[model samples]
Target: MTRRTMVFLAGFVAVAIFILGSIFYTKPAPDFAQGIGPGGDSVLVRPHSPILGPETANVTVTEFFDPMCETCREFFPLVEEIIGDHQGKVRVVLRYATFHPGSEDAVRILEAARRQNKFESVLFVLLEKQSEWAAHGEPNIARAWELAGEAGLDLPKAKTDALSPEVDRVIQQDLADAKSAGVSKTPTFFVNGKPLLSFGKQQLYDMVLAEVGQ
Candidate 1:
């Protein structure tokens, strides 16, 4: 081949390589909804209502929990202690996820109590004695009603309200919210809009104190 022709061919090859490299090297478009389901950082932005503690507290602790979960039953006291220690400085929100079929009725009953402004007391009693009602065999609503009665709630009304459409909607919304927030496990906690993977009471307290500048 002629030298000029060879040079032109080489230049063309170089330009093609440059163009392809630039196309490949260009940054990809960002996914605005990435990492948001069962395993993602975007789970923290979802909104949930506070179930305990002061509403105006500086630190918001959101717990995605299952009523029939044994681990959640164990963690209840630790959480209660934390709330007691913090007093008005922390807000605790419980997002009920009905992971087990057994949890459905209990969740509905609790939702009903919530309508009557007796949810906190009822929830505390339920969690404290979860093993009794959540044991093997068919769950006993009568036992649950008795527990509610002990908690100063109107057992008959609570039972009726538990079967209402409003309770069903609340449970459905809780499940949908959990899916949107990427929650897969029970007793997942979020502190000030961030997931808490590992931390003890002191660590949690320090983190909250730092956030509050106390």
Candidate 2:
């Protein structure tokens, strides 16, 4: 082939390859209306789920999270900010996944704090000091307990309540629901019953905004 023809052919091949790669590698967004897995609304939100806004909100953001999950900790503030931006229109319901080592103990501690109306406070503390207590290998659950106490939990009472049948029931129910919801990640989020399949800070915010009609 002539030099000019060869150059043109090579450019055409490169463009074709690029287009084919885009089609094959790009992930299509999940269907929002159909939702994911079984149990439907029952698995998305529960009576025992920790809520962060008015119960009557039109938009519900259900998050399946593990306390010891690094990404969960990072996204905590983002979730809170989204709720704050929407005022009473958006609320977040937290369901435990507890996939990390020693995370069940953290879940128990948070549930215990719930009995005293200190769930949010203790949860904040735990996430803030997560690296210290939720470190890999051997987690320092004792330090987590101490942190919960410092976060205004009644140490003696919280320790006892953490192991109660009620707390165990909460853990079991959430795990079952997470499975039913097909949640395989530490921080799976569903906005208005639509799974956040795109999975990004901006994507989550956009999903919530779309549901909020903003």
Candidate topping TM-score: 2
TM-score, predicted candidate 2 vs. hidden true structure: 0.81
lDDT of each: 0.72, 0.86
Q: What shift in Å separates residue 133 of candidate 2 from its native position after superposition? A: 0.7
Tens digit per residue, CA lDDT, model 1, 1-214: 9999999999999999999999889664222234222223344323424357766676667788887788888777777877787788776678878887678888877887887889889888888888778774566666776787799888778888999887777677778877866688887776776656564555655665665564
Q: What C-alpha lDDT, on a 0 to 100 scale, does residue 87 get in candidate 2? A: 94
Query: Candidate 2 — what's its lDDT?
Result: 0.86
- Candidate 2 lDDT, 1-214, residue by residue in tens: 8999999999999999999998889665443333222223467777677888877788888899999999999999999999899898988889999888899999999999999999999999999889889988788999999999899999898889999999999899999988877889979998877788788999999989998994
Worst 10 residues of 1 by lDDT: 30-39
Candidate 2 residue-pair clash tally: 0
Runs in model 1 deviating more than 4 A are 1-50, 136-138, 199-210
